[model samples]
Target: MQGLTPTESISFILVFLEGILSFFSPCVIPLIPIYISYLAGNAKQVAEDGTITFHRKKVFFHTLFFVLGISFAFFILGMSFTALGTFFQSNQLLFTRIGGILILILGLYQVGLLDIKFLQRERKFQIPLGDREANPLLAFAMGFTFSFAWTPCVGPALSSVLILASGTGSSLTGNLLVLVYSLGFVIPFLLLGLFTTQVLNFLNVHKKFLKYTVKAGGILLILIGIMTFTGWMNGVTKYLSKFTPPALTREEENLPPEESDTASESDSAENSEAKEEPVKTPAFDFTLTDQFGNEHTLSDYKGKVVFLNFWATWCPPCQMEMPDIEEIYQEFDKNEGDIVILGISNPSSAEYPDNADKSKEEVLAYLEDNKYTFPIVFDETGEVLQDYFISAFPTSFFIDKEGNFFGYATGLMTKSQIYQALEQALAATEQPSE
Candidate 1:
């Protein structure tokens, strides 16, 4: 899989760090010591003589269970924020701005620039019904309750996850994405809990780092907020979409039967009159490489009917028409006519203007994945397409035997339409030989 961009990687790291810091906010941090003390209540005092200082594995498991509960609670909160953003389409921008501002405020709070009284309000939301006595399970319940009640404290981290989820285009994927994000936060909390005393001691000695860390986080939130407000982030995403290839247009589709028949009659009458005159045509030839790296020349297949299909990997209609082309190829393969189907994949690359660096291997993979077995040629330089002045995808040209251009189609074609064109080419080529 392709790795994420530098910006995406940095953003994810910031979000993960924000989660850990939120867990250590003043409202939540002091309570961790209280909860640990409660869980170790009489056990620690009885073992003060060092006779039974170590807790059993059961105690550890209970503590971990509480951690799981907190993670799940946060995950659900993230889901709710995502759902709220998705349900109302008209106020999407309004909600996005609100979320961004909320994140900015939380960041400022972390830097001690702002203090909201509501941030300190804590309620006993998670009641432990079964275990009134202190156990690891009760501690877990406390952790879960803390996650729900401390929403204002961790708003920045939660907002980041909700923003990511909203962009996923579906609520289900968004919810799961936040769950993964919660894991990013939960892992550190579990580790800190395992060695709480050591962590507190380390924090005391390196207290200066906390201020700088919070400032750095604040700056990141400010940048994200600015980008969100100005729509620069969305613009960047939109600009990237230009790399996608163009699709077929409706005007390029063939005319209906009545019009087609009239046009055909007019052309036939004109051709009958022009038969008495002589015409001169330029010699056209070129060398190109197929997807397999094999070279082919137009001159080599001189006395044959060749359907040259010019297309690109990114073109959706081009992708759709491949099967019809393949069916035509199969029919012609068994016929007496010297027919050949040649596919030219137009090149596109970031380095090459108007072309992409879509490798031959990648093109082959796409074809194989889609079950396309046509003989495809590569045109990384766009030499063939430019030479023919072809501007649309799936442009097909019928070259009769003896190298005469019979006719062409500029857009998508059905199986019947292609077969009819092939029959016309066959007739045109047979007339010269007869």
Candidate 2:
């Protein structure tokens, strides 16, 4: 989530808040007593005044087990969405459209525009609540299994969160966001379980507010569906970017190295001092082997431009833009080593689920299959990628002949983008002293 923008952070916040609101939804608020009774213990003691006998410790223990079950269910769902998002990185437009469509359908169902009976049907796990023994494991299973029950209020929120997760294009980030959203839901459920007497009374008094809250959730779902469909989330973030911390953008990538907000920062003093004005970013030096086990080093290519790229074979965008990268490399004067293009491959299955644990032979095979002519190196330890603070795939770093970082782009680059960065690096290398 290195590239997380203000808009995305805000989205996570909203999702979490929605989770909390789910507790107050009509379908859920009315079920509080059932949840409390089931989670606290099946066997209950009642007082003469009809006040349930409170066993706080037992309730907490059983509720914790229930929460764990809920976590397991949500975590898996979140991860699945994240993986799907990452898999569709190449076709983000298509992915976004499909995700948007799904959200729209769910939203329509919420707003009463589309009455899907299957979606409306109550599908809760049957735990045989009354007279049953206080079984923690059973409660846990109920919590996990019942997440798919699809109540009106929770359904919209769950679908909304899934769309948001899929939009991020990173599994770890998607998983974490979903977990935060789940926390919002779980906290309230836990509170209800813990303090049955107080909350039950509160729910009774505010009974009329429950339906309205569900409506509010539906409205929110509709709004999110629109944003997801139009890809306005990023647009909103871009608009607010000035007040927020620096973020990567395609517009920024097209600019010269001097114009990049992130690329200009020095990794070390040796790279160059970080300056408000033009300053050399410490040069990245590494000893890496190409697919042919040929040794290459930054120092070896001294007095030449290194168009360093961090990429993975599994990445769609990476694959999409590589042909352009190869074209640029082919035009370079390799005989004099005036310009070098080295693509550093991060061979991790987590980074590319479909292409994990790539060996030298596999890497070579992939390059050959693609007919790529540019030089390629495998970043086995992955330190090279982290050293560069790579926030996205298909990132490129332009190193000047002086071995200083010139400029970089965090995503796919056009042939013109590659040319512009090269021209800037060449210019920076020959920059005159004061």
Candidate 3:
């Protein structure tokens, strides 16, 4: 939570809400009584005069174990999705398109707009517990087993959320999103543990409402798919960011300039001196000016690895990762020539007709307001943007010491990821020209 942005917080909340909705799916809700009965075991007591009671302590413990099992399955699923997201981070635009379309289709299926045979098929493990007392272990196993049972009903909503998880910038955030979702889904179960009899009765009486849950979930998924596919989620986040607290500075946390300089010197000294044959493949070189009126040409920095970040002021992901970039820039001693971090932008003009249209003055003021010192060069003619084939807002290219195009990663990257990328670029041999 140290650097949780307003946009991230909002996204987490939305995911959590989706989890809550999943719990109310038609498959899960109508059958709650049977599940609770199995979990409750011998805890239930009945007396004359139609009175009923449950051993709250025993029931709560059993339910706790059961929910934990569900959480375990959910966590594993989240990790898988997060890993997929990381793998596809370099082609985020394509991933977004595919994920969005898949979610939208699932939404339609859920809403009865389309009938998908496999989605309707139930695949649950048969665990017979007839005339047997349910212990904590049994409850836990059953909970875990039943999670698969509920999948057919919850798949649409859960899959949609997982797709979003796959698009997150880091595994930590992605896992946390799943955790929040699990909490939303399981909180009701925990509440049922505490008040088993009342909850069962209430659900039974209001069973009619359960049928609507799928439609509502479908609508929600549709909205999410549209937002993600069109990249409008960032715009919404940008708007809400105005209401959040101002950005916090991490100056005290960063390494001092002297120490950073010494580290850079050590890194350079330790790097391999035996040179391999240089490849003729060269990066597209261009001349541009930074916000501070400093002119930088790509070919001038031949012996240093360059982290070239293409970004725009209007891009939320770009803005989200700037602080991390700033930290790297400072830790590498600002522009010491061993490793250079630079940002590339294009102001709105006929040459570059796109959503990012902030003039040079606006870009400067924005940078000044945020106190970002990393050098950003303006591609006035938009030639460099085209040369790079930038299909997304926050694409980055790594250039090796020989001025060869090393590699590129699309979307947001954490500070550690940036460091790893720089190291790879520094260690890489010159590539053959295409």
Candidate 4:
């Protein structure tokens, strides 16, 4: 439910750039002429004084429909990937690890270090252009069918993107990512349709550059794979977030006295007229003891803004953000104030061996050694983690004072972001009944 953060924005930009690079793939750029010829088969062309001119009006609209068809196919692909992601959302950590490994192998294939035969083989539907004129309908059908025409050439890049899309937090995010990539791949096609002669001349001249596109994309995928596998992307995201200006401030807390009085009067009237209903508590509630042996239930903290952070002892990003959590905990009077900060960890045990590297004893010892005073709790059975759909380490959830799910953020967060999220949670109002 959160707005696009700096990390998401950066990811979208990279996906868009990847799409643009896909257009210049070996199978794509070289075959542009053939595709254009099919699209503008009957359009007039004039050759005058060593220069070429295409019938722009005739070809442009056809190209538009062709790209639209490609876009439609891409959208469908995005939806399918997103749906798959949603189904596997609970096993997010497993999905990320598997996806990272797959991406790494694909990167190797792209760099020529590995030989993946299926990837090297191209399989696409072929449409014969014997005598049919290039009308908008035909162009659209061609664009849709031919989208799979260069699968082998674009597969590596496209697969990497689909893997990313499948791991996103929301279906909408995954779909938007694919849309951005489609824009990158199709914008060039649209331009070529408009200025076919000029683009063909440029491509013919600088054809040497096309060979490097795969290599560049391969290196990028490799880096992303390593970061994702090691859980370092969250740290990078946290670092980048430092450059984003704070979205909200505490100035609103210092309203004028007259305005406060008026608000208080309005609240009094509303409270008198409004009937009180039992506050709905969410289902992820649990009774767990902290390191100090004091048990806590999520429902018990209904009147307070709860900052529940799901982390692991082995996660570097989790360790990196501990100090900030400690600082914030102290600022909030160590949970004595209206805000309560709790760290949830699922250490490795016979029951949940995949959850963490350390045992519960080791986790407690680590907390003691680090002198982290914030309340640290254990999800011994790991049910809490499943209920929360925790795919990545250092994921934080914010609950409003009314115990409603305000929103959540994945990856590490800075102190400022943590504060902003808490503020937003505190300011959030309850959803009305249907």
| All candidates: CA RMSD (Å) | 22.5, 14.5, 12.9, 10.4
Best by TM-score: 4
| Per-residue accuracy of model 2 over 1-434 as CA lDDT, tens digit each | 12212112334666678678766654344344446656655434567996655467777778888877777666655443245533433243454555456555655665578877554432111222235455688778767654533222354455446534533424455677788888998898787667855554454457577456545656665665566566553333223322322223333335454534234333222233332233233454789888767878987877888888777665667788889888887788542557899888856444433222365566778899988878788777655653453434666767778776555555566787678667656765677743
Query: What are the Cα lDDT values of the candidates?
Result: 0.53, 0.58, 0.63, 0.63
The lDDT of model 3 is: 0.63
- lDDT string for model 3 (1-434, tens) is 11111112225665677688889865466446545766766676666975666678988998999999888766655454345533433344454556566556666776788777653331110112124376888777767655644543454445444533433434555577778889999999998899976754554456567447546867766776676567554344334333322221111126553554355446434432332222233576899999888999999998999989988788777899899999899999997958999999878654444424387778888999999999999988665764554445576767779786655555666676577667756765444332
Shift in Å, residue 349, candidate 1: 4.8
TM-score of each: 0.39, 0.40, 0.37, 0.43
Candidate 2 ranges with C-alpha deviation above 4 Å: 1-247, 252-278, 349-359
Model 2 earns a TM-score of 0.40
Ten contiguous residues minimizing lDDT sum, candidate 4:
121-130
Please give, for residues 155-227, the per-residue lDDT of candidate 1 as tens digits.
4345445434433324454556566667666676566446533544444456577446546666655555555
Candidates 3 and 4: which is better by TM-score? 4
In candidate 4, which residue ranges exceed 4 Å CA deviation?
A: 1-85, 88-200, 208-304, 310-324, 327-340, 344-366, 373-395, 401-403, 407-434
* Candidate 1 residue pairs in backbone clash: 66-140, 348-355, 348-356, 348-357, 349-355, 349-356, 349-357
Stronger candidate by TM-score (1 vs 4): 4
Ranking of models by TM-score:
4, 2, 1, 3
For model 1, what is the C-alpha lDDT against the true structure?
Answer: 0.53
Of 1 and 3, the candidate ranking higher by TM-score: 1
